[model samples]
Target: MPRSPLALAALATVAVPGLDAYDVRRPAQPGTDYDVAVVIDAHRRRWVVRAPAGAAAGAALEAEVEVLDALAEHTASGALPFAVPQPVGFAHLPEGGRAAVHAEIPGTPLRVDALQPGPGLAADLGRALAALHELPTSLVENAGLPVYEATEYRQRRQAEVDEAARTGKVPPALLRRWEELLEDVAMWRFRPTVVHGDLTAERVLVADGRVSGILGWGDTVVADPADDLSWLLVAASPEAADSVMEAYQLRRTELTDPHLQRRALLAGELALARWLLYGVRSGNTEVVEDAVAMLEDLDEHTRSLDAESSATYA
Candidate 1:
């Protein structure tokens, strides 16, 4: 059962300091692992409270708090253009777990499908992503986050594909395609950098035609930067994606990786495989069936494109 917003608010008042009066309400839809709410104090200061939904979620929340705490101190120099949420307080829940409160960040999450590229929002997102990827690797390392080299990351992805294949649910063609991509060593040779490992469209916040803030820092790591670009490639319009990639290349300090775009596309394609694996592991039949249906649709689409290309050449 889900926890009540008012009950969470009552917990927040006790956890947070000097909060005499406040209004609490559900924020966006609850995340898979947590329930979140917005708390507005009498002074109009806003804070977000998040509570874990399970034991695994509890551990993840703790890690997120640590990462946010580290970033808050690390970014004091104001090197980045966007804002990152800062942890303000914590509470011990009656259910024998922990909850956290973060200072509310400005701006609302961008809807990728509805975005209009004319306002330069795409470029703003690009620049923001570049800045995040370019952050010094020491920050992630110092925070005790996971770091993966090119080879190790590729191997991990291959392992996931293999795991999915073992379930016998993934289409053989999709499995073959993913295997071929993962084995292409030439395409995997890019320097690892700091990455927001779980950058979804909802994680980005926009205001005034600019990326005002980025949320959900729990998955920060040192890994292939292409992982960060996958969501944009898969979700945004072609024109918007092109605009973002152009801006990202212009803002990036280092030479652009030759196969970055290809790897990013591959990452997007493999996301379904990951989802399927997650569902199987979690014993969620609905999620597993949904992923299988998506994979079948993708296989049909790929065949249609192949036929079209062959006819064009003929």
Candidate 2:
């Protein structure tokens, strides 16, 4: 088997010329077990290195490799359009097991600056995501990866909440929100599409006014395309998000599912809950702090949704 993504991220950080002096940091948010190092090169080239840690260490590494392989297969077969991580030399760590070097794509993460909905950026990104979703469903089915319907996703979170309760990892406020959100997600239904599993602004790389790279394929899975679209919607302003959805609809007409918006909201909550879990387990302060904010936002949204659903029927 090839080297894991966690190993690749570590090696990539160390191998980059003149980046050795910068302090390596942990994940800046909650429910994330990845160790992130922000390095500035001698010429002031900034890059980030993220490796999985704790029990997540080995599984994350392996998952990243699988994601790359899946991307390669899809890209070669003309089913996918994004550039995936290419692994170089790797190391074997006792804790994380394997670390490999990844070719650094040139671009800044999308979340760093204020995002404007340009004429084509949103459409381009949305369509690109759609292409990934358009892959052969049977192939993914054969792989036995978890397919996250909204209910399934919520159930997983409930399971996590139960785990947290047993372990004393979650606070009462967050746990209540988790329960409320799970109830809301149970009523949702959308057709399945391949999801990025970990869709966020940080994972998207943009350059020269366009999206140049989409990074972090470790969380790839088959699920609702709305899960992937949620990032674009959440990160962009409403107008920008609308433009993006319009562009996406033009390229991949299948994105017109009625349940799109609902699933998007659910996905965001799920992401927040996940980060919270990561923070608790890894003891990352930033992750824990962010999880609090995420819990609040998710709580409000879930309540709004529940009210809206009740109003619609009445």
- Runs of candidate 2 with Cα error greater than 4 angstroms are 1-55, 76-79, 94-96, 138-144, 148-187, 253-255, 270-314
Worst 10 residues of 2 by lDDT: 22-31
Compose the digit string of candidate 1's lDDT tens values, residues 196-253. 8888878888888788888888888999999999999888999888888888888899
Q: Which stretches of candidate 1 lie over 4 Å from their true place?
A: 73-75, 95-97
- Please give me the total number of clashing residue pairs in predicted model 2: 11
In Å, residue 236's CA in model 2 sits off its true spot by: 1.7
- TM-scores for the candidates: 0.94, 0.66
Which consecutive 10 residues in model 1 have the weakest lDDT in total? 70-79
Q: After superposition, how far is residue 53 of candidate 2 from its true place, in Å?
A: 3.9
Query: Residue 180 error for model 2, in Å?
Result: 9.0
Candidate 1: what lDDT? 0.85
